[model samples]
Target: MNIEVNSQNLKFLECFASDTRIKIIELLNERPMNIKDLAESLGFSSAIVTKHVQKLEEAFIITTESVPSTRGRQKICHLTLESATLQFRAKKQDDQNRYAVSIPIGQYSAYDVKPTCGLASDTKIIGMVDDPRYFSDPEHVKACHLWFGSGFIEYRIPNYLVGKQSVRSLSISLEICSEAPHYNENWPSDLTFYINDTCLGAWTCPGDFGAVKGVYTPSWWKLGTQHGLLKQITVDSEGSYIDGIRISDRTVQDLAIHYGDDIRFRISAPETAAHSGGLSMFGKQFGNYDQDIQVYVAY
Candidate 1:
């Protein structure tokens, strides 16, 4: 996870403010445990530990799931975020030089998804869950959240660069994560990105998130995929980067993008990948970050 040191991320930062939360994190790091077990380990009451758990869950540092136990149902807490990078500085860019657009998650021009896949609008499921044929249902355009165990999804983006506007950099941001059956904090998925067919390298999503409800997700949603990590992929004059870390040597010039060209962006998780856990994409109405796939062309 990569986060900026700013007001917007204060909640996540605050997760480390308390010693109790820190100890809870350390204990969970070794293994997933229920509230009763955690409280006993910390010499605290279940109610007190529950409060601490909620704080960590809000920060996305941990996830909890209700499962059958000897005593009935138990909420087992698991460590979700394995690591995080705190970015205190960012390079300044002129907004005047850029044109941006937000692409809804389901507005894909083409896709090839397998089973354990489905789509959902803010109000209901798009079609049948785990059925690929439903991906083509006319109502798919209304989807705010979508996931697949494997395969790819593509989107067509309009290139708005006008007369002689040479590209400086191209930025794409979205909330995404691994797709596990129900949910799994330890699952990893190798996700690859493409621009007009040019490979931008791949990123390994750490896990499928749903340990708690997403801030923007519908209250009735219980599919286990609550939210995802926000990722920023950029291609500039020098190279391509994911969350400021260079992933590939592919550059804007290498992409050869020109005025009036339609950009085809693809996100895929091939079954042959080392991780192959799958992928889940969240839109403005489905994830912690209330935004769709945002694209920016800077020239």
Candidate 2:
């Protein structure tokens, strides 16, 4: 059978094509950095470094998050994969084809949010901070992005697969990072994913994002939190994968999802987490990537 990554695979190669971004990667190989440090090290303007970093992130090469700084929020860029390579040939007879769909960040069917939390659309805040009451506002459906310090949010993935829906595999993609009362470069959070109540696995997000402008972020948003790393969580008979890399033994059969059933995707920052850093999510109208939470079903 054939294989593919979460985002466009070529997008990763495109990131290496840039000389400036290569330098950034090289530096990160030595240590992670914030925008200010990268700018200073590269002798480039903060704006310029931000652009290059975004390109690397779009391709899933590097990830950025915000942390506490004397000047306020600071962004730390970390290297994801040291190096990645690919091969392209002809599609095999057993090659599997798939269908895809996208959901906005704010359109969750249910939510249990807490203080140090709030929601924002592409253009404005959904409601006042720390007020779960506003999460029910009909306007929330229009939100392109949202954030919360603690708790979990769940979205209903619409049933759209038609024909022989063998449902060989299922996947969800989103831009996300750890959340905190305020940005902290060193902050860590254990982010967990669940499908139909089955705990797939947990990924640690270093910190919340802020301090720079997201590529598609609205000007109305202050100069903090551009976006988070674009990631894909997938499940199949083969088990689970994070950005195409195996993370656990949990598989599609574990969830027992069928074509007629509604697929629920939930992200949680439970109290027992080692970090409890919180979480922040981005939508199409926000973040460097111009896509929302994407769901892919391969049969």
Candidate 3:
């Protein structure tokens, strides 16, 4: 969805540009904590922390709730934004060019796995099927180790640059593949995707990803073993997409990327479903490919 960053949002970000405020944000990233706990952890006075939190709350950078505590009432603060898409207004001269933002899958902080999993990048291998105690892996995996029910490894794409001007349309792309041992055409794997909590669409990949060689697939990797799913979601009258194919006709407004505090890209499966299959997504499992999520703004 398209979002215009007006003066209000600019002011909102400016509120957290301070050192103290930034520290508070970092701490809250872990989980929601009460003001007393936050004050003790940061070694700051409760009054000072309360003042800063008040400013953050006013700017909508955080939200606070009152809860019962051993010491009586407590204020708990938490971050409201999952990820932000910052669009700086362009100068008149640079309006003709289109700009894009690319967030590599390797940059995610909380890459998790459950039933079975692995992740591989252009540089190294991580999460083997046999090894269960490898959680502190680096960001350069050629393929990832993953499992089911652990939810998806989320990535944040801060709008670095939209060039000099706004665009008529925007597009997003990501390269994905299955990480299963066996390949069957009728396995019925579902990958539910979302943008800013809005369900963009769901893709049920055909089991056999081994038919075609992946674009950046390694030579050592057996062909037809596991190919890749290159899905593209375009924002236009036609709606979202999957692998250059259209799956939904829902409008950009329905996706709600423009209205929210931050734009979050989430992938997860619901509990209730018709087909009871598992998922094995490989972000950068092949050759030199980077499983990147790109935002292309066309002005």
User: Which model scores highest in lDDT?
Assistant: 1
Deviation (Å) of 152 in candidate 2: 1.0
Which residue runs does candidate 3 get wrong by more than 4 Å?
Answer: 1-97, 109-112, 130-136, 140-150, 160-168, 211-215, 220-225, 243-246, 258-262, 269-272, 280-291
Q: Per-residue lDDT of 74-175 in model 1, one digit per residue for the tens?
A: 998977565677889955679898899999998999999997899999999998999999999999999999999999999988888789988888889899
lDDT-best of 2 and 3: 2
Q: Give the C-alpha lDDT of model 2.
A: 0.78
Worst 10 residues of 3 by lDDT: 140-149
Q: CA lDDT, every prediction?
A: 0.90, 0.78, 0.56
| Among all candidates shown, the one with the greatest TM-score | 1
TM-score of each: 0.76, 0.74, 0.51
Model 1, CA-based lDDT: 0.90
Candidate 3 shows a clash count of: 22
Over 4 Å off in model 2, which ranges?
1-21, 27-97, 161-164
**lDDT tens digits, residues 1-299, model 2?**
12344355667767768888889999998777999899999999999999999988887677787779888899889775532324355223343467777888878899898767777887788878778788888999888777777899999987766665667788787888877665665678899999988899998987666644566788798735567767778798888877667778998878867768888889998877888888888888887678889888767
